[model samples]
Target: MMVTNLCTSPSSTITLRADEWVNITTIPNKPGTKYWVSAYVNVTGGTISLSMYGDISASQHVSYQITAVNAGAMSMTYSVVSGSPTVTVTSMLICTFAEYQANKTLLDSIEYFDGDTMPRA
Candidate 1:
């Protein structure tokens, strides 16, 4: 497994206005693998506008969301969060998974590097 740094906002900072949706960045989705998205938001629990396309968004706010696409890219957006009208994201992670059984010896290194988290996308 490997965790990859896909994209970040300019200077790793973004401030979203009330009810505003800002395009954070885009990520590529390779075939035959899953992506684990971890976003570091200023607020603990707030509505982070994350979805594939537009129809897949959830009703409530969530800090993280997973995307499973065949072969293409996804546009990420940040909208609103709870309690506060503005939200700032310091960083984000887009990790891809690689089977460890293929190489038993390398498992140790992967474990040390990511601790169960996938490495670079």
Candidate 2:
């Protein structure tokens, strides 16, 4: 149920280094469980590629998703695929599992989870 959200301020964003892979803060993980990852990024000055999440175009606002298999403080990474410019990361989330179950009704309006392998039981 631990959610590790990456962002500086409500109106600010993160800048990714050019030609390098960046891993935001890690999130809690449990083996044999499925976790959801979501992010809103602005890829400017280059094409940013994420690890298993997907890629974004220059000056685009994109939302991406990915699932994790690693346990204990897992991290999601992004890289610049083409241009030598950095990517602007708006908001990100490493959430799922317990938290979603506890807040099922409250969060249902926000996002939905299959919960089959979420460790809710």
Candidate 3:
């Protein structure tokens, strides 16, 4: 399984810029598979918005694009403007069909067959 992770921390306030793009790539790169992508941010006294592309799945590998938006704090709500937004990806996983099939075959081979039924102990 291939995995990727991203994390971010912002002090006070920050705003995201257009040029700044958070990208996660080079997963398994398998077709018909699903991948899991997630984002996590640790910040205090600030509001943040997150956006990303691609669906979260565990059967395939995929890429994602994420963005973050920051809202100013109460003290600077009106006077202070949010700085560049920062985004952090928390976790990613690529589960390909080949891996799944291999696991299944291994499991099947491990089971003991008795007469007409197979028993797993």
Candidate 4:
């Protein structure tokens, strides 16, 4: 059985006022596989906005991405972990078939200036 685990430290960190946004990305060292991803934030007075993408599966390794949008100085963190394959291997070592592997990818965050500017509907 093969397994891999990955995590992001500072699970929560402050973003300075000058900072527009926070972006994080992760690339697994292993081949095609699934991965589980999670994120949390700790903001005292102000509100914290968060966005995350990528495979959340525990069966294999996968690329992950996270972005945070905050009103003021705040802290946030994201994590990724991988687990064993979903398929079961028998003692006889008989060959079995499974679904084809698919690539997982995520996009980084993009900060927008001027809160007055509204998005197009």
Candidate 5:
């Protein structure tokens, strides 16, 4: 259940351009393990795309889950689709698989009620 910050510097942000991928950071890959990667970014002009461990995500605060299949470094990158945008990578985190499973277990234990009967599961 270890949590790690993947950004190289916390006080700085990276600006990206259209059709260009900017490398944020590269994290260590533990084979057979799962990691949840999330980032806090501000996008101006257009939306931005994020990629890590071959998994892709987009916009603002988003998380991408991926499993480590080999040993090495897993790099995270970002790109915009339209005009050059100023982006602030406020926070980036990589959570362990156990933490994810634990959160899922907690979510599964909850029952949502919509007035009279509970909503469909």
Candidate 6:
């Protein structure tokens, strides 16, 4: 089994202002490929806006992106963390299209069953 490491920044912190989009980090991306990103940002307050592109409003935050369509940038942003202006990005993970598909295939092979009936021990 291939192991994927979680990207963590235990001691790192970033501040975001209310109603303003702030660039957080950028992930390496490949053109013509898709990516699955999971960002774990600790926040407490009014709201938090996150996106992969700049100029995104709070209502425009997105979790998935196609690299080619967005000019191959995997940047991240946070519009606000309100009551608490600072936040810690506990962990994050970015999975490429190929890696996602490979994992999907592996999982299916190991856990999927065709019949409706339960398999006997």
How many residue pairs clash (N, CA or C atoms closer than 3 angstroms) in each of the candidate models, in the order given? 10, 1, 10, 3, 0, 0
What's the TM-score of every candidate structure? 0.44, 0.53, 0.26, 0.24, 0.54, 0.46
> What ranking of all candidate models by lDDT puts the best one first?
5, 2, 1, 6, 3, 4
What are the clashing pairs of model 2?
1-99
Q: Which candidate number maximizes TM-score?
A: 5
Candidate scoring better on TM-score of 2 and 6? 2
lDDT for model 1 comes to 0.43
lDDT of 2 by residue, 29-49 (tens): 566665544445666566767
lDDT of 2 at 63: 35
Report the lDDT tens digits of candidate 4 across residue range 1-121.
2111232222223232212333222322222333333232222333322233333332222222322233222222323233321221111100001111121121112111111121111
Cα-based lDDT for every prediction: 0.43, 0.50, 0.27, 0.23, 0.50, 0.42
Task: Report clash pairs, candidate 5.
Answer: none
The list of candidate 4 runs beyond 4 A from truth reads 1-3, 8-35, 53-121
Off by over 4 Å in 2: 1-12, 18-21, 59-65, 97-121
Task: State candidate 2's TM-score.
Answer: 0.53
Of 5 and 6, the candidate ahead on lDDT is: 5
| lDDT of candidate 3 over 16-67, digit per residue (tens) | 2333433333222333333222222322233333333322212222233222
Give the alpha carbon lDDT tens digit for every residue of 49-120 in model 1. 434322222332223445455555533454443443345654444444333333435643433221223333
lDDT for residue 76 in candidate 5, whole number 0-100: 45
TM-score computed on alpha carbons, candidate 6: 0.46
lDDT of 1 at 52: 37
